[model samples]
Target: MSLVPTVHLPDDLAAALTRRLAATAPTEASAQVDRLIENYRGATPTAAPVLRDAGDAAAYAAYRMPATYAAARSALAELRARTGAWTPRAHLDLGGGTGAARWAVADTWPGESGPRGTVLDWSAAALDLGRALAADASAPSVRATTWTRAPLSGAPELPAADLVTVSYVLGELTPGDRASLVDAAAGAARAGGVVLVAEPGTPEGYARVIAARGRLVAAGFRVLAPCPHSGPCPVTGTDWCHFAARVPRSALHRQVKGGTLPYEDEKFSYVAAVRPDGAGTPPAPAANRVVRHPQTRKGQVLLDLCAAAGDLTRTTVTKRHGPLYRAARDARWGAPWPPDDQPDGVPDSGGPDREGAV
Candidate 1:
């Protein structure tokens, strides 16, 4: 006879069970777990892979995973050291799925008499995980508060905070949503307050981070880390700066996904924006000439109107220059509107639109 080993839930799971079960009888909780197991057993094998949900069993399991917490702690430490401020009276974790950011923040500020934190996410499941982590840390009294409301576009009308963090959440938003989140984060930071925004290190992810950086800069935040005041992201288009993180798999997580081992791969990037004490107004945009790409049959050019910064860079494949240039231009500035009726422009040899000069 062959024996299959039963997988045990991670410590965080046990803690969550203990907390939630505290309100209910152990027998009842066990029965509920059994029922959940049975439900999973009957689930169709062909079911689609679970999508990432804000507050779900999978998200909770992911938060409990060590890698996620470690990365968050590293980021927090870096931000704190750069800002030269130790104790924070209040902290806010935006889109803090499963309270991973909350756990990380509490751990980072251990034994510090000050600093209460609030974990805000759309999922009740995530809030439960946040509560569980807090309870495990044995500081539930000091580290209390969880917000289930979605973040607003402008400043959030919640409690004020000295340190605010938005981690691994911006990439999940649309462009407009990203802008709104950035604005809200800036507003949440009090004078001399710090706002840290982090995301995965993919092209799309970095692009979103860059967009947030722009908004933060406009709102009067200073860049604390990562050399180079401001420039194009260094990653190639296809490859991004992401890492593999291990997170414990729970029944809730497994029910949503199936087994676990290869944990989540989180691509992350972070920026700390701070408002200086007694600072009057934000600095003006950099006064650098927008570097323009030399006119080439196949090259991309990006123009920054505010800074008058432009650059023309060669692309991997010359064939993509037209589309890339058009995209770059649209991204930096609004669509170019040419005056109607002009000299007969030479048709683009490569395509219908390529021949015209803008």
Candidate 2:
């Protein structure tokens, strides 16, 4: 079975985002959707100004919420699996647009006791929508999440929590601002807490994540997920490592995008780190991270792995490799692989070389 946790929004939250969607006139809603995406894609130092109007906010909810929710859930799934958690009692959702992170967390850990949290964002309208959705949640802990309106950079204060997530917010800030935000989020994480950061999967996005990862380590945090080691990154050049999650489009989403595909693949890059000192022991580091989706052929499988040596290695397994080949065939993106020398026990080159034939 797939280990990734599925993202299922509470019924009321979905209803809140879509409740007003049907009232929109197609042409006008379409234009709002276009502008929202354009502005967000090119955004720097701001993402809420364009979403001020209610229609635009609704359109954005239709356009981005599902994908963002899926990405957050996927990142958190990887983080929890690699580093066991004490079961967070509280969360701080930094720039959690429409409170997607909160929803994802609730779904990821739907235990008897849910997590109470806070959502901080610059947009009042976005918060309003979030509050409306949250009000529908049956769990008191989730419904009680506080929404704070404040600047993302140089903010006076942030909530204290067991988990802090800065999701889909880095794209709106300058490089320096992104770094500053990471620092702030790191500080907000209570000792022994976990901090998760996620961004688009573009090369530029990867650069932002890489820079933040370096800074987080410098700040004395332990790197987790999407990276198996604490040293410098291994993937380089045009081959940036990212993972993809499929998000099923809502009816409103289909209308807004003017597409028929039921789902869209959201490619994202993320980092989950912890304040290692007081943080409880983490799971033993995996031997390698399957950075890319495995490619399977008739009797062979090609895998791109980020090994513990901090380098990307392309290792191919053929039927002759026996059990290793079977495991490689089933490995998905963001999963881990065991350490095995090049077929016949060859030392791993760690260079950009073709996977040796099985």
Pick by lDDT: which candidate is best?
2
Per residue, candidate 1 scores C-alpha lDDT tens digits across 1-91 of 1011122333543465445434443344444445434543463221221222323333334333344554566556555544443466788
Worst 10 residues of 2 by lDDT: 338-347
TM-score of 1: 0.56
Per-model CA lDDT versus the true structure: 0.51, 0.76
Off by over 4 Å in 2: 1-13, 23-26, 278-280, 320-323, 338-358
Best by TM-score: 2
List model 2 lDDT by residue over 110-172, tens digit each: 765888889988888888777777777766666888988877876437777888999888878
**Candidate 2 residue pairs in backbone clash:** none
Question: How far off is residue 17 in model 1, in Å?
Answer: 8.2
Worst 10 residues of 1 by lDDT: 334-343
Per-residue lDDT of 71 in model 1: 53
